[model samples]
Target chain A: MSLVLRETALAFRRAPLLSALSVTTIAFSLFVFGLFGLVAVNIQRAIGNVAERVEVVAYLKRGTPLQAVALAAADIEAFPEVESVQHVTEQEALARARRDLREFQDIFQDLETNPLPASLDVRLRPAFRDVQRAAAVAERLAALAIVDDVRYGREWVEKLDRLRNIAGAVGTVVGAAFALVAIIIIGTTIRMAVLHRSREIAIMRLVGATDGFIRRPFLLEGILKGLLGGVLAVGLSYGGYALIDAYLLRASFFTAAQATLGVAAGGFIGLVGSLVSVGRHLRST
Target chain B: MIKFTGVTKEYLKTGAALKQVSFHIARGQFAFLTGHSGAGKTTALRLIYLAERPTAGEVRVSGFSTARAGPREIPRLRRRLGIVFQDFQLLEDRTAEENVAFALEVTGARHTTIRPRVMRVLTQVGLAGKANQYPRELSGGEQQRVAIARARVNDPVVLLADEPTGNLDERATRGIFQLLKDINASGTAVLMATHDLDLVRSMDAHLIELQQGEVVYDSAEDAAGRQPVAP
Candidate 1:
């Protein structure tokens, strides 16, 4: 193992320029992938923020007692998908309309009796905030004795679902494409490194070195380069994130685990690239 | 010991390199393979080292036969023998000592033993003082000596030299030839391929001459017909 390390060091020392070039190339490739990942994460967060507003409002009958509505709220909150249920009095509903819909102030001010009905505002959990789940919960709420009608903006919820699905699908496909490009570029850079040392490899084989022995140093070099490149890529991605956050809209950087995964992906790509390049060199010569 | 029986090597592009060539070298013998540029001398040496297999017949070296040796066994067989080329195939980036140590290192020799063994062979080739010098810093003759030191570091049973002195001047050629002679005197058989007829005539060594890929003359087989010989 020490010998392997020594050989790896020797290779780097022998061609520092080429080694640096390889690492830089790998870093940039992974950087592109990292940029896409950042975009995907931010898009997903935006969709999630929008989904949080998804709630079903069940309007109560005018003659329903407040005591009965409180009991219904308790039962509705017990549902697995229900995050929370709030009972809004008819007066509170009128006040909300006055605060939220300022453009309809003239009509609301002229009203003698409160036209709004008391309602149960049912907010679903984030996981159950899709069109289908919201509709299912609305159906259940409307079946209650006191619930005269239910309104959760069916078309709006469906549009949000469509937007979420498109974002997820596009994220996956683009992410995969970027990752594949990064791998191919990294593999090519490592191949150039292997070819740079072709003479040394030929000498090793001539001196009776086994294929495993010949591959060890190159493998180590590849992994090390990959790891370094990965860290560099993460750094580059962070720089990009900072620039975007400062100049454009505020954006979320990768979580700690995601950043670590990015580094590991770099190392993994390096290993695979070195394996292929060295394997080809060994087989051909 | 090295022996070839009816060895024929055919390439797809160039056709046959060696055509039914046969020769034998006993243990501890110093032999010269003399031929013109395209006379299959390198191919014959390559066969002895297992770099290329003979299309027909067999190459038996130190109990390993080309017909029977598996892929896994090739490195093991190579470890028992030393191979030298005219270009002095040393890693240019490494020092002479490092180049010599590479051979021992490949065989997984003890790390502690490598330095001493490398020094011994470098001293044997009279490059003990220049062990730290890289190949580019050394002359043609000195670089070849480094290569010889690397070859001899393994204490191989046989040394196969494919035009070891082809790139050297007359003085360096004499020096390398004397070095090989000294190595041969220490009981390691040397089979050298060279087109230098003058070098072939310089000493009383076994000679094999190839012409158009056929062995026209072999000192050991003046009377024996082209038949397989059991070692």
Candidate 2:
């Protein structure tokens, strides 16, 4: 353990510039990945909020008995996908229309009979709030004997779902590409380090040092680089997030758990990249 | 102890570097491998150290057959032998003591054991006062001494020197040779490869001369015992 630490310290002392360059490259790459993660998280939260409010409105036929309407409402309420169902009478519907059209309330007073149909407002469970499932539920309601029409904003919900899917796919592809670049950057840095210390390696081999002995210091060097880079990336990402929140009122987009995961992933990539580079060079020599 | 029986090494780029060469050095025995450049003297030493394998025959070092040793076993085999080169190969940024400590560090020796052992070897090589000096600050002879101290730090059974005096002045060469002789006197077998015929003759040690890739002479059997064979 002391040997590893000493060698790692020596390596850093030997090439401070190169070490810093590697760490900075890793930090920037992880920062980009963290930014994408933040955006994706916010997009998902927004989509979920929109989906929660999705409800199917079923209009009853004119002159339908209240008892039949109540029976249909009870049947809809029994569905696994249904969260809650509210029955609105004709008078209540007319009153709601009057409240919504307050600027023209005098026109509603001239009508002797109420023109608004009674309806059932059906709220769906969160899991069944997707466009396809909600549309399926609305179709089943329309087939009921008392229901005259069903509406669930099918077009708008579909558009929102498509947007969410596209965002997720884009985030994944971009994140993977950035991760690949980080690995390549770290690999190149470690390869340069191996080349720089070729003489030391040759001497180590000459003095009966095993492959593991020679590789330990370099492996430790890579781990240190990755750890430092991870810390830097986390700091930069959190600082950037705070700035965004202060300026645009978008605070709390990235959670602490997500930042931890991102840093851990970055550190792991750095370690793997360093190992591959060192292993390749050692094998070739 | 080292033995090479009908050893042949063929490189793709250079063809056969050594052809059917055979030799042996018993425990506590010292010998010189004398030849011109490309005469396979270094190749012979490398075989013993497991740096290169015999293409056609066997090489046994410290009772382990290098030909059959796996990658994991090679280092274990190497630990029984020490190697020195023409270039000092010392880490320029490190102090002389640290360079010597490297050998012990690779073997996972304890820190308390490493410092005393390193200082003892440095003092043995007559560089005790220069232990804290870097390679760049040390003279050529001092740097080479540090390299020798590093090789001796592990107390290997067989010390292989590949042109150890190639880059030294005559005075420094004499000092280095005397140091190697002192090391040999301590029961560590030494196999030194060099083309300095005059030096080889003056030492009165066993000499195995190589021409091309074949053994041309073996002083152990006297010059009249073996004729020069072409590869």
C-alpha DockQ of every model: 0.82, 0.68
Error of 1 at A61 (Å): 2.7
What tens-digit string does per-residue lDDT give for candidate 2 at A30-57?
Answer: 7777777776777788788888888899
User: On a 0 to 1 TM-score scale, where does candidate 1 land against the true structure?
Assistant: 0.95
In candidate 1, position A83 carries an lDDT of 94
Residue A43, candidate 2: C-alpha displacement in angstroms: 3.6
lDDT value, residue B41 of candidate 2? 93
Best by DockQ: 1
Worst 10 residues of 1 chain B by lDDT: B222-231
Q: What's the lDDT for all of these models?
A: 0.92, 0.85
- Candidate 1 structure quality by residue, lDDT tens digits, A25-46: 9999999999999999999999
Q: What is the interface RMSD of each candidate, in Å?
A: 0.7, 1.4
